[model samples]
Target chain A: MSRTFYCRGQTGQQLLLGAYGALCRQVGLGRVKMFPRTEMLDLVVAGGRARGIVTRNLVTGIVEAHTADAVVLAAGGYANVFFLSTNARGANATSIWRSYRRGAGFANPCFIQVHPTCIPRSGDFQAKLTLISEALRNDGRVWVPKRRGDTRSPDAVPENERDYFLERMYPGYGNLAPRDLASRAAKRVCDHGCGVGPGGRGVYLDLTAAVAGLGEKVLCERYGNLFEIYERISGENPLHTPMRIYPAPHYTMGGLWVDYGLQSTIPGLFVLGEANFSDHGANRLGASALMQGLADGYFIIPYTLGEYFGGAALGEVSPSDRPFVEAAKEVEDRLARILAVQGKRTVDSFHRKLGAILWEHCGIIRNAAGLGAAVEKIRLLRAEFWENVLVPGDAADLNQELEKAGRVADYLELGELMCRDALAREESCGCHFREEFQTACGEALRDDRRFGHVAVWEHAEQEREPVRHVEPLTFETIIPAERSYK
Target chain B: MKFTLFIWRQRNRGDRGRFVKYELNDADPGMSFLEMLDFLNQRLIERGEEPVAFEHDCREGICGCCGMVVNGFPHGPEKGTTVCQLYLRHFQEGAHIHIEPWRSRVFPVIKDLVVDRSVLDRMMRAGGFISVPTGSAPEANTVPVPKEAAEVAMDAAACIGCGACVAACPNGAAALFVSARLGHLGLLPQGQPERERRAKAMIRRMDREGFGACGNHRECEAVCPKRISIRFIARANRDFLKAFFVHPGKA
Candidate 1:
């Protein structure tokens, strides 16, 4: 018999949807069984080996445990912890918490990338909009008001009146400074009130001259979709007007600590794609995320798995095994406890409140004082979340509220860990910028003396501090130097 | 500005899709076509109706998740622009835009505006790789590929796999997608061992996926978001014909 595969809903759905379609065409759709919107509640641990997985099918309201030789978690990273992340709707930091609570090792959940350019938040209610890529910065110029407190639009300022800060600062790379630096620069200007857009939260990315000089055809060729996206969100035309762009938490460079083989500290469980922290050291280069994901799935994992299986001498373990049953029962009991709770606050309400606190305290810029306050705030919020949180639906159905509640519960824990990690790493390197660690020139200072290792956190008991495992990075090719575009 | 949108709506693979029209008034010139549609869907949801389903992830021009025929162009009239990159500012005040899913036998419509392009993935599986073993990161300058050659290969590697080439093609040929991978790997020394075999295997897989034969319409090159040249198609054809002679068994 063929081995059964365990995967989550959204991420798993996209992968299996493609994989099944390809496999079915090769060996008929009759041979494939796809399960979506299902929960992988527990991994059956049998004699230091992963035997099977227990899952609850949301569509059919059936709880089933499937036996498999190996389990792969392409679940994704903990981006939802940051209130301002640009991750998809379904993914939450809770998944990471559940995995850890069930004894999965995770790494660097705090090394999140605040994409240097995104459409700034329009209203308090707006969650997060789409990000325009860094590629636009190659051609489009970044500018702000020359005056320290000017809040005028691009049309009001003549060419000489505007200050193209990036160009003046770095002539070589200019506006295309690696994401971390660029994001900081935008924040600095916005905080000074020279920011454009509705809330003075963005700077102008002008392509009006580029459009006129290169012509619409050439401009469209370079950035058509980006132009469309800008128009859609901001109601502006790049062909005539400048686009208001700012940074938001986009991709997480930090994830479950995995080796070159994409295997985590846990033996049987494998993390691939964006879930595993590899390739990208501190900051990811342009157009590399897709490369890493496809490379991990299609090229890397298959060979690594073959080598692993060959060495392990693994045999089939049935789903009826004792450990599988126990794990499944544990999941069921947890769900029952959550469902039994009758509370007043809705899941969305708690999540929104959590997001607000996180964004205010932990987002963009962070210092020890802010992080300490955030930790206390998060602890208090988590307590209220457990006590007053209302989940309107049952686990058996497509309960959006239940899903959000579970994810928010995870976010509360993950947010605390993020602050702890941020607090511990005294140096500002790449995306992780602590206000206390920056230079007088507004550049991130790297303290290679004390903190140049990957921070891997081992999950401890509730209210107990997690153990930290340090993996010292040895760079053979690129020597550690102050990254200066100037 | 106000405009009329002609969108393609197909329920499933067997269902025949046609252009359905909707009107919008005082639209922002800054909004993308998809964003405009998103606004329309938000309205539809408020009225207790099913929103139009579309495939999009990472709205930045990278992920290759979103693709469709917009105003008879693969990524609209924009050159080197993907659908996700197209801004509404390029359009007139009262334009009538026609939109449709990629018309290809290999890529069938899954739902409204979403098409299955896993056939491209199948082609990649057939060969498009370096066959390097796992473990240890290679030194950056170890390969010593000339900057020119590396740049060309990188350019080819930039193909987003959006299938706009197929959407733009009259025959719905996936040559642009196939040739891009072929050229990307084939240009490198790491791809030397399986050079002939890779070309033969990938082309065969491309044919097996039910994509039409390349007829040199040059539409694929025209609409490519990265502006991958047609020279790659010729390179792929040359390699394919050469492989037919050298590796008959593999072909």
Candidate 2:
């Protein structure tokens, strides 16, 4: 009766609900209750199995323990921990990793995906920028000012003066150089002052020609919403003008290490959807996140859980077992400590600081010195955060502030692991680009010899560094080679 | 360029919301409507006033998050566009723009402009997916669907679920959303096993959710953020009719 399913809102919840409904219908069970944005502190470990979960309900200010035969963690990935993210509010990488680290689970805290095409920087106060999908690159063209010092308006610039670099470099894929390559190329151009937009941080994604040639109806059929989004963000009509876009940290392809059964190293503890590092190896393809999330929830978890539960004698063992009760108390204690702090710095303040370091150092083009500096800075910030940080409201009620503090607390620790992961992996591959590993053509040079394996970090005691476990990636279909856009 | 905006300001669904005007000077023609609102918000923040709240995500038009009535159109003056992508260039300098949230019974206005579209999610929950239990990753090619069918399914899958079609329709019908789901599942072999039951269950759930019946205004197709075709609606109707006879008990 106490089996708890913890998942993110919107897509993840829908997937789980659908699966739950199907399973309940098939097995003749009672109705299922859904909780949104709740935090799981730890798994109740009794007899070496995940007996239940100790969780805090974010909506109503109650700290209740749910003892279940099993706990499903589908809370999503840590893209929100980065200074600039394409993710929503709850997905702070550091906090989620720390929560698992507190328990017995492997957190691959470093596998973040920086989406190549997002609306470029608009202002400093902008918390999170919007993403324009890579699918647009299929038909749309990416261009920048040919002249190094040119700062002309998109309309003012002549066609000859604009450099269609993606088209020039890759005759076949053109603007579609997968997400990673396209993003790097855009960054390279912008770094060279060919960047468009007000901050000079983005390039122009021109579809004027496409619109004119395809006619409004055909073009509208394809990219109508994108056009609307562009207008909403940039305040310009794309029917006549080109859109300004750049890359931002969108999705995290990495997370808690899960096996084929979607179970992490911990027994009776399962991770699904974006929370588990299952699908989308290094960089995720467009429209794949939804597919992967639904796939895990609807198609993957139900089958796997049945096998797990069958071994546990179905509903014979409930979460109310002793291990679950003990774990629930520990979670309550952790929440009490957070509320006890009552410090000064807001959660947003700490998160913003953490995000800035990650974005500047561990983001896009990272170097060893930058990564090292990031770790030192993050450690200093963590010290200040724990001491001076403030939670504005009580944990009860619809407290967004309390929820943010909890998520950010994890980000602080997770940020350190990200820098460490970046530091450990010296080779440039996929979204993880190190300045040290580039060819003469300025393309990423993958050092497959030492860095091809997935770095799964085992949680160590506080103040002690975590141990690294490498899961060797064996490519079956696609050969690992220099990813050439040209 | 300077322009005036007439925006709908509603506290909640029950309250009668009206148009509020604001002026913007030195605005770029290329800036999106949301960006203009962002600019307006920046000014409001400086003045220590609360800014207008609106819903949006995945500016690429894939997430089905943002939608609004702009200048009497679901997206804006520009046909087939979402509110996020409509730029100011379409408007004449000094012209007035009207902005409002999608009007429908199912989508109750939550704040100034945001509406609770969880009704659509509820409908999907009724029976939007196949009865495949989660386990191993099936080879994508395991189903052996024809390339043409897959492409058709992919087209239907492009629906972002922004609810623009419902907003645009005079009847407040969710035919576009329903049709997109129907089309996606109907064409695929993976969806074959539960086709009739799914059709009946989804329609019954849609009716249960208090969404108005489709009136064939075709406005849903016109304002769809994805420009999802009306053909899907036809396909849905055909499937529903077939399911009604084939699985009468489910209906």
Candidate 3:
């Protein structure tokens, strides 16, 4: 079959709406049931197999147990745990977290890809960061002023005085360098005090050269929506000014460990998209997210799920089944416990504090000291969250706070696991960078012999540490080697 | 920087809501409109009060998750801005902002600022999509859409489904949103096969959803965050007319 990279930039939204449209059509066809304002609260495992799910209606806050022959978690990534990510506000780790707790192995929990081109953070109250698509790099030459605090307009920063860092370092790729390399490069420049914008936390993705070369009209034809979005957020016209971008949390390469059939270790439990840790080894390339999501949803799941449903030794599940009853009670008790605390700090406050620990200690650059410190800090914060996090709303109505409380509670647990995953790797590979293991010239040094295994963490008892399992990555036809653009 | 925000507070679809005035002070001018709400919510939660339940996700204006009328404007005074994209700086210091939900009969209030806009989703299912099932397509480039047509399709395609159009439209018509889907697919050869079916099915579904007829007030275009034009409405009307005259099966 022939292949091509074709989309109008908003491919995910288009394809999702299309799939959603089809799903809605199925509802019309009486072939599918619709659940719009509902959220998966927990997984219901019966007879040592995945049987059903516990769900909460976001509108009424009514917790109900729905038994499925097989449960598929299409719930998205945990990037929102960062508190200021490019993820949707409602995106959380609760579904996957519950599944992990129910014995689905959480693989490579530390593998988060911070996208390079995003509008820089403005203030503390900023809920989410916006992304300037990767296409901007095609026309935008990334650079920082040679002098610290230059305070000169991008055009005024004379060519020699301006350091086109990407070109100077990775000359072959330059502006088109991959996401991970570009993100770290941008971070390196900013840490040195030469970054642009309000807090000096941005690098210039200057389209001046592109506009000059291809003419502004052509650039506008290609990137008008993106340029307009940049201008809308920053109040700076990119036709005249440069778009300031920084790396922000975009995708998590780590998720539920799925086997060859896209089913988790637990039978009848299937995971897809960003929820499952499959394909895209350290970093994800652009636009494949849409393709993979569509392919899995439209193609793979139908065939695989059919095979499972057809041949599996499954029994009709009742709401009174041990796992169903226990899971539902656990959710109810947890919510009751959170309300019982009556703490003073808002969920957002604790989330922000937790985010700071992870970002500062376990972000792009990581070392033994930082990772160890993060693990301890997350544990303490998680305790404080249960004791002092204030959730004001009752669990009866459409209470956003109550909803957030549940998600944040899961994040506290998931965030700690992420730090542990980061610490255990002990070598830099893909987006997982260990400060102690890098080359003298500073690129990710892969210790393939020791760490070329998918670190799968299984849940232990409440107080005990989670056990880690290794799935060694054995390449059949390809050989892993040093990645260099020079 | 301070503002008196009179937010409509409803317990549920059953509750008759009223405006509760909140005085927010020391609000950073840089915070987005939703962030200011977050500030209020944090304060409320600390005070043992139920924080305002508003609809929002992807707070970056694209997801169609956020919907509210701010001070008589659908997304506040900012032109071509969703409520999520509206910054606090746009309002003068100490201004009184009236925040309300989309007050259409079809889009009943869920709690406070959130209303059920799933009607649009239902209407789309009726025929908004091309008949092309997933993996049933030839290679994407094989269709070979004309550049100008694709551009127009994208322009119409830019509707974020925020329902600001319905709130802004005096007739409560969803023509702009409905037409965008029609125009987007109709302009492409891939959409040609299902053109009449789409127009017939979607229009029937929109009417069933109880939206008023388009009086062509053009209010929807005025408040569109993507600045989607009403030209697509005319294109949709043409498709509807053609479908009425000649059913593909009858012809």
Interface RMSD of every candidate? 8.3, 6.5, 1.5
Candidate 3 CAPRI classification by DockQ: medium
lDDT of 1 by residue, B5-48 (tens): 88887655667777788887866666666667666664554444
Best by TM-score: 3
| Cα lDDT over the full model 2 | 0.73
Instruction: Give a tens-digit lDDT track for model 1, residues A449-476.
Output: 7888888888888679988788898789
Q: Which candidate number would show the highest DockQ if scored against the true structure?
A: 3
Worst 10 residues of 3 chain B by lDDT: B242-251
lDDT of 3 by residue, B1-251 (tens): 89999999998888999999999889988888898999998888888888888889988777887889998878878888888988877789999999999878989999889899988878877987776556778888877888899889988877889999999988899999999989988998888988977888888888878899899899999989888999999999888889966685432
TM of each candidate vs. truth? 0.67, 0.72, 0.96
Best by lDDT: 3
Worst 10 residues of 1 chain A by lDDT: A1-10
Report residue A238 deviation for candidate 1 (angstroms).
0.7
True contacts kept of each: 0.06, 0.11, 0.67
Better of 1 and 3 by DockQ: 3
Report the C-alpha displacement of residue B73, candidate 2, in angstroms: 10
Question: Which lDDT tens digits does candidate 3 get at residues A369-455?
Answer: 988888899899989988988887677777788788899988889988989888898999988888889998899999999998999
